[model samples]
Target: MSEAVAPRAAIIRRLSITRFRGIGNLIWRPGSGVNLILGGGDVGKTTVLDAIGLILSPVNPSTLSDTDYFGRDIESGFEIEAVIALPVDSAISAQVRPAWPWAWDGKDAVVPALDGDSGEPVYRLKVRGTEDLELIYEVLQPDGSTGNLPVMLRRSIGLVRLSGDDRNDRDLRLVQGSALDRLLSDKGLRSRLASELAEAEVKDALGDAAKKALADLDNTFSERSLPVGLDLSITGGQGASIASLVGLTADRNGIPLPLASWGAGTRRLAALAIAEQRQGDRPVTIVDEVERGLEPYRQHALVEKLQDSGAQVFVTTHSPDAIAAASKASLWYVDYTGQIGPLDTNKVARHRANDPNAFLARVTIVAEGLTEVGFASILLRRALGAPLSQFGVHISNGGGHEYTLELLEALNSGGLSFGGFADDENGKHPTRWKALEDVLGPLLFRWPKGCLEENVFGATPEGKLEALMADTLGDRTGMRRQTLALRLGLDAKTFPELATAAGDRLRPTMLDAALGTVPAGREEDKGAYKSHGGTWFKSLSGGRELAGKVFTLGLWPSLKPQLLPFCNSVRSAVGLPSIEDLPQ
Candidate 1:
C-alpha cells in the first residue's frame, strides 16, 4: 500500500508590523523559496523574526519580556498582523471561518484585491500588549474589522523559528516534542499520543523493541528525507517500566554523540532537519543569521537546501556569499527608515564585480577595471577615515567599460545606488556612453584624457611622469617572483631603449610599450592593458597605495577640479557631507 500523501496547506502571504523592537512600521511580503533579509546590525532583521514567532507559533509562549516591546516601552503596545490565505477545505478553516473575509475568486482562491471585493478572505493574526502589560493575540476578521477570534484558530498558522543562538534546543526527543517526533507522525502532525504515530503497531514498544522498530523504519527512509541526520527511538527509564522518547542521541562508529556536543553548524543544520518535518498542511521557517558558523561551500548550499524544503524560508545575513547565492528578487533591504521591501529585478540588472561584499552594500562604486577598484577604494577609505563597510559602500571593478552599464542596471534593480569612473577613451562609443550618461546623469565621472595610467597617474610627454613614478613607486617583490617581470618583458630602465627600437611597432598611445606587452623590436600594435601592463598592475597589488601617491605628488590639487563631480557623487551615496560643503 502507498503511504498517504499529505497536501501542502496555504502559507502566510503577508506580514505587517508596528512599533515592534527596532521596527516602527513595516510590511513583509515573502515569496516562495527564500526571503533573505539584509542590513547593518540593529536594523530590525531579528525583530522581524521575533514578531512572526510571536503571532504564529504552534506552542503558546510565555508572557512578553520587557525587551520584547519596541523601545522597551511597556506602555506603547506593539502589533503584528499577518494574512494567511486559506484554501477551500483548509484544515484550520473550520476554526477560523468567522474571521475569514469569506470572499473567493474564479479559481476559488481569495482575491481581496479583485474589483469591488469588499474584503479579502485572509486569516489575520494580530498580537498586542494590554494595559496590564499582558500579551494577547486577537484573531481579527479578514478586513481587520473585528477581533477576539476562537482560541483554536491560532493553531491555523505554523511557524518554526531557529533562534540565532540555541538551535540545539530543537533536537530529537519525542518526549519534549522534538521536531523529529513531529515529522515522524502521520501527515507531519506534532503529537504526543499513539494516534499520531505513522505506524500504529510500533507505538507500544518499551526499549530495545522501540530501537528495533526505529531501525527497521530507517531502512525505508534515509536521513536525506529530512536532509539532516536524526535517527531516533523510544527508551524505557533505567529503573522504571515506562517508555520515553529518546531525544537527540545519535552515534558515529558506535560511539554515542549527543546534539549538545556538536558544533554550532551541526546543531543548526539538525534543527532545520527537524523543522523540515514540522510542516503538516502549512509551514513557515524563520532563521536568523542563516550563514552563521557555516563554511563557504555550506553557505552556498544552505540557500539551495532551504529553497527546496517546500516551505517559505526567511533568513537574515551579512555574508556576501549568501547575498550572491540569493536571487535579486528574494532579497529585502531594511534601512534606518524602517522600510523592508523587495528589489526590482525585472530590469536589466547587473553586478559585474561579482563580489558579495559589494552586492550587500547599499551603495557601490562601479570602477572601470581592477586598478580603478584599488584606486577608488583607497581614496574612499582615506576620505571616510574608515573602511567602505562602515558606510555601506562597495567598490566594484566592472572588468571593463563594456560592462559598466550592466553593473549599473543590476545595482539599480537590487536597490543599490552606484556611481562610476570610466576612461575618456570610452567616448568613442556613443551608444554605450549615451546609455551610461542617461542612466547615471551627473553621477558619472570621466578621466580627463586617455586611460587611468595616463590621466590619473600622469601621462608621459605631457604629465610630470618622472615625478609621478618616483613618488608612487612601491616595493617590488612579486615582480621578480616566478619570473613575472621577465615574462612581461618589463624593465623600466629599458623602456627608452625599447621605445627607440620599437619604432612604429608601438600603438600611437605608446601604451603597448608602457604595459610591456611587446619586446622593443617586435612589430605589433597593442595597448598597455592588452600586453604587459595588466599583469604588471596585478603584481603591484598597490593600486590604492599608488593612487595615494598621487595626493602627495601634488596631483590631487590639479586633478581635484576634474574629479569634483565624482567625489561629490561618492559623498552623496554614502550620506556624507559633499566636497563643496567642506571649507577651503
Candidate 2:
C-alpha cells in the first residue's frame, strides 16, 4: 500500500467578520481545498479575502482608516476572527502548543474530555480595530487569558495574498515578511551580506576610477563645511538593512532584469512560484480576481494548479474558464446582503458543465437551449433599455429540456433567484414543470401545446407564410426545395407547388420538417427534410434571426400574451420597472 498523505496545513476552519468594509456581518466556512468565491460586483468578495489577510498578516503595523469601517462609521470598529487548524508538527503548532485547548473534528469545534484523548489542536485568532484607529491582534485562550499574536507566529502560518492590481510585486523583494525573506531567513543571508559589504573588500571591488570618484565626492562634501564623509556600504541611513535593499532578478542573455520589469500577470505567477518553492511550508494563498491580465488558457491552467497545490486556497473570479477549471473547488455565492451560501457541487455540476458564467450573475435566466437563450437575451436587452448585464441578469443555456428543469431545481435549492424558459415538450414531465411553477410563479415560461418549432409555425399568419418560408430555408431556395422534394418522393417541378400548396397543407409539412417529426415509421427518415437545409432556422444564430424577423413581420404583438409575464417577472427580480410602467 502507498504511504499515507499528510493533512493540508493552514486550513481555516471558520471565519467571522463584523463591521468591516462593505460588510456589516458575514460568516464563511471555506473548504480545505479551493474555495472559489463567485458573485456580482460590490458583493463583498474582495472584502472577505481582505479580512482573511488582515487577521493573519505578518506585518506589525497594518493600515487602518475610517473608510475601512462599514459606511464610514468608525464608532463601531471592525472585528475579524478565524479558527485556523494547524499541522501538528508545524512551527506555529509548537509555539502555541501550551495554550491549545480547542479542537476541530472537520466540522464543529470540540473540547476533548476523555483521558488520553486529544483532538486536533486549533487556535481562535482574532483581530480588532478600535475607534481610535489602534489595532489589536491576539489569541483567545481557554484559561481566561489572551496572548499577543507575535509576528513570528503569524509568519509561520504562511499567508500569501495576490491582489488584482498591477502593483503587487512586493513578494519578489527581500522586504520584511515577504516570501523571499522567509525563504532566506534560515540561511542568515542578511548578516552575512552586511558583514561582507562593510569590509574593505567590497570597496576594492569597484574600479580605480570609481574609488577616485568616491574620494573626490568625500573631499567635496568636506569642502562644503559638511562633517560627514560618504562611503559605499550596505547601510544607507537610520532604520535601513540589507534585506530591505536587496531584490530578486531574472538572468536573460547574461543581463539581469528585475521582476518588476515583467507584466502584472508574469509577476503574479513569479510570486506564486516563489511561494511554492518554500520547503515544508504550505501557504494559505488568497488570490483576488484570478483572471486579471491573463488569457483564457493561462487562467484555466493557473486555477487547476492552485486547486491541486495541497495548500488551502481562496479565489475570487468573474471568468467562466476559471470556474470551469476548478471542478473540485467549493463554490460560494455571496448575495447583496453579505450573506454567503455555499452551493452543493453535486447539484450544480450540470450548470457548471454547461454554462459556468451563470453563477457570476445575481439572477440567472435558465433557458431551454441556445435558441431560447439567444431569443430571450435579445428581447430582454431591447425591453430593459440596455444589456441584461446592466441589471445583473444573464440568460444561460440550460443544455436541454430535462436538464433545464434539473438546473432550475438546483438553483432553487441553492437559494439563487432564477427564471426559466422552455418548450412544453408536448406536456411531458408535467409534475416537474408544476413544481417549478409553484416556486417560480410568473418567472417560469413554457409553451402551451408543443415545442418551439410548432408554436412559432402555428402562430405565423397565412399572409406572411411565404416570407417566413424563405427566411426558414435561408438562401439557395432552388437547391433546398429540390432536397425537400427528394425526401418526400416528389418531382422537382411540383416541389414548390407542394411546399406552398395551401394553409392546411403548407404549415403541417413545414412544422414536421422543422421539428424533425417526418416519415413517422423509418428511423432514418426522421429529420430527413432538414438534412440538406430544408428548414435551417433551428440553430442559435438561426433563432436570433428568426426572432428579429418575427418582430419585423409584426408577430410579437400577438405572441406577447404568452411571453410578457415572464419578461416582467425578470424585470421585477432584477429591480427594473415592468413593461407597463415604462414610458411609451
Pairs that collide in candidate 1 are 9-281, 172-247, 172-248, 173-247, 349-409, 349-410, 350-410
TM-scores for all predictions: 0.65, 0.74
Residues 1-584 of candidate 1: C-alpha lDDT, one tens digit per residue: 11112236455667888877777777767765578887656557888888877776554565667676677887887888777665556545565345555342222224255454333355666778654667777766545466664334554445556678854455444433335545554432333433344344444444887767766677656744743332534333433211124447679789988775677777777777777655444457787887777887887877778777766778888887776676532767664344575654433235512555544556656788877788777776666657878877777777777776565655444333457777777356767666666766556776756776666545233234333333135543233221232434545344444345444542233433234445454445434335545433432254665566567555676566766667666666566777652122
Best by lDDT: 2
Model 2 clash tally, residue pairs: 0
Q: Write the per-residue lDDT of candidate 2 for residues 248-334, one digit (tens) a residue.
A: 889878999988778888888888888988987889999999998789999988898898799999999999889888888999887
Q: What CA root-mean-square deviation does each model show from the true structure?
A: 13.0, 6.3
Please list the C-alpha lDDT of all candidates, in the order they appear: 0.59, 0.76
| C-alpha positional error of residue 453 in candidate 2 after TM-score superposition, expressed in Å | 4.6
